[model samples]
Target: MKTRYTYGGDEHVYVEVDDEMSLDAFFIGLSLSRLVREANIPGVTEICPANASFEVRFDPDVIAPDEMMARIKELEGEAQAQEKRLDTRIIEIPVFYEDPWTHETLMRFRERHQDPSGTDLDYAARINGYDSVAAFIEAHHSQPWFVSMVGFVSGLPFLYQLVEREKQLEVPKYLRPRTDTPKLTVGYGGCFSCIYSVRGAGGYQMFGITPMPIFDPEQKISYLKDFMVFFRPGDIVKWKPIDRAEYDAITKQVEEGTYAPKIAEVEFDLDAFNKDMTGFNAKLMEALNDA
Candidate 1:
């Protein structure tokens, strides 16, 4: 893989791991970012890792831009030499597919959708070659997703499916961005899935809503007490579909500050996963279930 190094003004350095996005490129960027962090290079104030690239912020006075780039290049070599494995956590998020909240929002923005006559779910199903909406939803939750990036809103996670490249789900965003998307709305665009942390403007196709809160400024929920943001880069997510009753129950617990997301610690080996995605994911799911 080739990497492109560029300066983001004078205080930040932007590094592109590859010209295009891929799981390989993402892992390389992730590994490089981890190396940068562990190196403890002085003047490096912040590190932001994205899908296929990463950015580093530093004080120009402490570390010259040219020197910072040199250090990162060295770390990049080290990153390439290291094994592609990460100790991460897999989380189970309960979702109510085709839930009424997002349904109402999507209906209001039909004119901006690719297929105005049909619902987003139906349009996605037909385009993806699924016989029914249930099958489409099943395809979504059946495979685990990786948190490729987390942004656009505080604590909003952008997820990429863990299946092979051909099996990945792809959807187009709304023709025009919507003025309102319900909070916790599970949205999909391109090959990524996102949870709208707050009700705001968005362009991704709304699929459903999760009862759990991904972000909370007050940090009132038991799970969120330590940190307002619930997700981090490299985290694995499994979507678990739930009915209205379960949704309501979880919502009640959330309001009472008792809701906690299901999470289990696990190790992810890129090489092993690439060799046998099914077997690896089954093991990951087993860990989640056993926990």
Candidate 2:
């Protein structure tokens, strides 16, 4: 599984990996795990992790585009082949929509939280002790799941996916957007990836969060697009409510990057949220289906 090519003026190759999966897979694989293995490229100074993609920058004059492109194509070919043939696991996250599309939901959400809000809810959660993710996933079966945008943010991962789009949120850009839109935030339903929403200003619709974290500094990782997405490039998503135990377990998995919850405590009304949001509109899924 080792294939090498140059990308952005540096050499990037895919190496056959054991069955180990994590956020690092996205940041050119090993995001920061390769820090000690591969010395930082000269002139690149430091490469920071972001919510969009793991990156590196070298002196333009020293590294030519032709060389970079050549390497990129080589690595891209290899990575593409190794990716899962299908993203069959579209973790269904249950959301109450808070209130409803009419008045209550939007009103309450807008009451304290503004329209363009981030997933910085007031909750401090952490977990530890799990031998493998398999053990943990098994324990949480039938639990409620969530969907979020899987992006590398400052080395940690987070999810922010929208189940629906709203017209009121579609404000156009002042000037024409060109080559570098600065990769604001990324969201997905199937393979549809778009950079929208951020701490600053922007004009694009955003909704809902994923059941997983988009980043994890401790793990020094990132996630592959299909591996962390809600649906396959062709499958539809139907939001379903799950039990509180499952929600708590998976949430811990996302934040800690573990296969099981070791030493822990759970505190949240996940059951109520799931029950309230269980009767989600199945029709919305058709609109999202890539088929």
Candidate 3:
């Protein structure tokens, strides 16, 4: 598909790579955004990459809108010619599936969910072609997810599973948003998965909770020392299912400032993954397991 360039008001420029969500579109946005950052255009103030598109905020006085658009077009061409790989890190995030807290929260807002008669996991499992919640949970943890974008909150990560389209899990959001969502709540909406950074209002289907904090204003955690946000656009996240006992242990470690998450550095080749997802994901999981 061709990339569409448009102006966002008078100070921002937007580039849309695809209408549908895909890894290729995400990588294109990532590549162009990185190239634009490297250019260090004087007028550009911020770069925001989304699921299948990216936007740049610029100072119109320093650089005209037309000039910025031209520069973006140039960068898009450059990105197409650049390497197909992106430097990324693999993070193993621990999750307690069917956890009590998230389950309670969902139960409290059952009227807001599409399937008011059953729990969110039950509804999700049925729609995803799984016979039971256990099988659904297994599918979720069976593959690694790519952090396609980090937004909607300070550190909320929008993840896309690294699997073929046919194997992708899909779910719908709640009919109405919940007034309160616990911090680190693992939620899913449409075709994407997300980890709520803080307790607040949300509409995604509640699944479970992670003990670790992805966002810390104080940055006390060693892993978040470089950046308060634990994830970036191209980061790979693997969710591991843990029991309540292990979850409590990790929570205690987090409280004591002694817990360290498993993390590994790896190069993600978008082209290779698109060509051979099964093989690429096997290697990706190996890297995470090695970590």
Best by lDDT: 1
RMSD of each: 2.0, 16.1, 1.9
lDDT of 1 by residue, 76-131 (tens): 87777777788999999999999999999999999999999989999888888899
Q: What C-alpha lDDT values do all the predictions have? A: 0.92, 0.30, 0.90
Q: What is candidate 3's lDDT per residue for 1-291, written digit by digit as tens?
A: 689999999989999998889977887888899899999999999999998899999999999999999998987877777676778889899999889999889999999999999988899999999999999999999899999999998989999999889989899888889998989999999889999999999999988999999999898876677889987788899999999999999999987888999988888997788889889888888987898
**Model 2: lDDT to the true structure:** 0.30
Expressed as tens digits, the lDDT of each residue in 28-147 for candidate 2 is 332231341254344443343322233445555665545533433444434443422222233333322111221222233332332223221110000213344333223222222222
Residue 281, model 1: lDDT of 98
Model 3 scores a C-alpha lDDT of 0.90
Sort all candidates by TM-score, best to worst: 3, 1, 2
Error of 1 at 64 (Å): 4.6
Q: List residue ranges in candidate 1 displaced over 4 A.
A: 9-11, 41-43, 59-67
> Cα lDDT for residue 269, model 1?
87
Best of the candidates, TM-score: 3
